[model samples]
Target: MKILLLGQHGQVSRELQLLLSQGHELIVLGREQLDLAETDNLRDAVRRLQPQLIINAAAHTAVDAAESEPEAAFAINATAPGVLAEEAAALDVPLIHYSTDYVFDGSKPTAYHEDDLPNPLGIYGRSKLAGEQAISAVGGKHLILRTSWVYSLHGRNFLLTMQRLLQEREQLSVVADQIGAPTWAGSIAAATVQLIERWQSAQTATWGVYHFTARGETAWFGFAEAIAAQLQAQGKTVAQLTPIATTQYPTPARRPLNSRLDCSRLERDWGVRLPDWHDGLLECLNASR
Candidate 1:
């Protein structure tokens, strides 16, 4: 299959490239090649690639920063996706996009299902939700997979941030109130490829939203503790982590209290299950080592 991938340098995009390149032809574009802010350039790139599948992993992912720069976030996250969907529909290609668990307000006590109503608490979530709406409105063949707490060995994410902090700081405080799965970018990318292949085989409907996240849930503080434990097991000094409430470490944007996503639908549909967060974390850490 011929696949056109945006956000070539992102963690998920890189993993998708690694997985899909083994059996498919992949054309990837970095920020310079196809900037989201420039809709014409993005559309032109898609037209030129003329791929069988268009995977949009590009997004303005700075959650707290989006609170201050909502306009820029919307341009890249919301508006750009609509443009991509329009182009994909015109070209009759399947569009695969990634959304976020932040779309929910995190008020639910249990894992969120695909049918849950979105009530984004901050600008970033609102922007992503807007993108989802735009794609659906276009009546295009698209799959929007929402995931949370994504980490990878090759990107600026929670895992890397925790590792860096442990190296420099003796003690750190992480919010314990916000809970979600610590998903690996590699896992999400692999699932995406599987979904694409399934759709190609006439299994999936080619239009719907699904959840793809790691199994199990943990607060930020607990995730950091797990990282510290892994480092300690590997003969590194473990950092002292302090658990704090979200209000104790206030950011420019508000996050959902529960970002957990139920992956039962994904499993039932694709026959694929996400690994446990600790296992994924260990694999990533070992790879980095």
Candidate 2:
């Protein structure tokens, strides 16, 4: 399989590069090689590579920063995805893209399902939702896998931040109002391979949006507490995690309180589901150590 993967240095992209290195021809591109903000460049790269599959892991992931840079975010997250979808459709190849749980407003008491109507709360969420719509509008063989609270061992994510803070500070406060599954990037990468394999073999495979994340949910504070506990278990002095409300820690962009996504549909259809948040966290922590 010839795979053209975007976002070479991203957490999930890094995992994808490692996982797809064997038994496949992988062409990974970073911002310098392919600036997603420039749709022409993205299209040109795809045209030049002529890959059998396109996996877009790139995104404008600056959540709060997107509030002030909506245009830039839209350019990369929205316009670029539409262009990729169009190019993939023209090439008659499959595209696997990643989205976020921010598409929902988090007002629902229960976990979000794929069928739930999107009601983005901030510029970042709105831009991501726009990208999703743009990709779907192109009518290609695509899979828009939406995940939440992504963290990893080798990235600027919540898990790494907490690890640094626990090492430096005696105590820390984290927002408890916000809730979601802390998905490991490696888990996402592994599941993505499964989807790609199934999609290649299955004569009739459903292609659309699907929520992929860890099996459980927790607030930011709870997640921090888990990190601290793990560090302590590893014989390291950790910080005291203090729970705080969203109001106490406001950001430029509003975040969805309930980012819990229902993954039963994905599991039922593909027989793929990530481990529990704590379990994934342990694996990440162990790998980092």
Number of clashing pairs per prediction, in order: 0, 0
- Cα error of candidate 1 at position 115, Å: 1.3
lDDT against the true structure, per candidate, is 0.89, 0.91
State candidate 1's TM-score.
Answer: 0.96
Candidate 1 structure quality by residue, lDDT tens digits, 1-289? 7888889888899888888888789888889787899988888888887998999999999999999999999999999999999999999988999999999999999999999999999999999999999998897788899999998988688888898899788889889999999999988887787787788788866377889899999999999999888878879886688999999998899999999999999888777677899888877777666
Clashing pairs in 2: none
Which runs of model 2 end up more than 4 angstroms from their true locations? none
lDDT of 2 by residue, 249-285 (tens): 9789989999999999888888778899888887876
Best by TM-score: 2
Q: What is the lDDT of residue 65 in candidate 1?
A: 94
> In angstroms, what RMSD does candidate 2 have relative to the true structure?
1.1
Q: Candidate 1, overall lDDT?
A: 0.89
Name the TM-score of candidate 2. 0.97
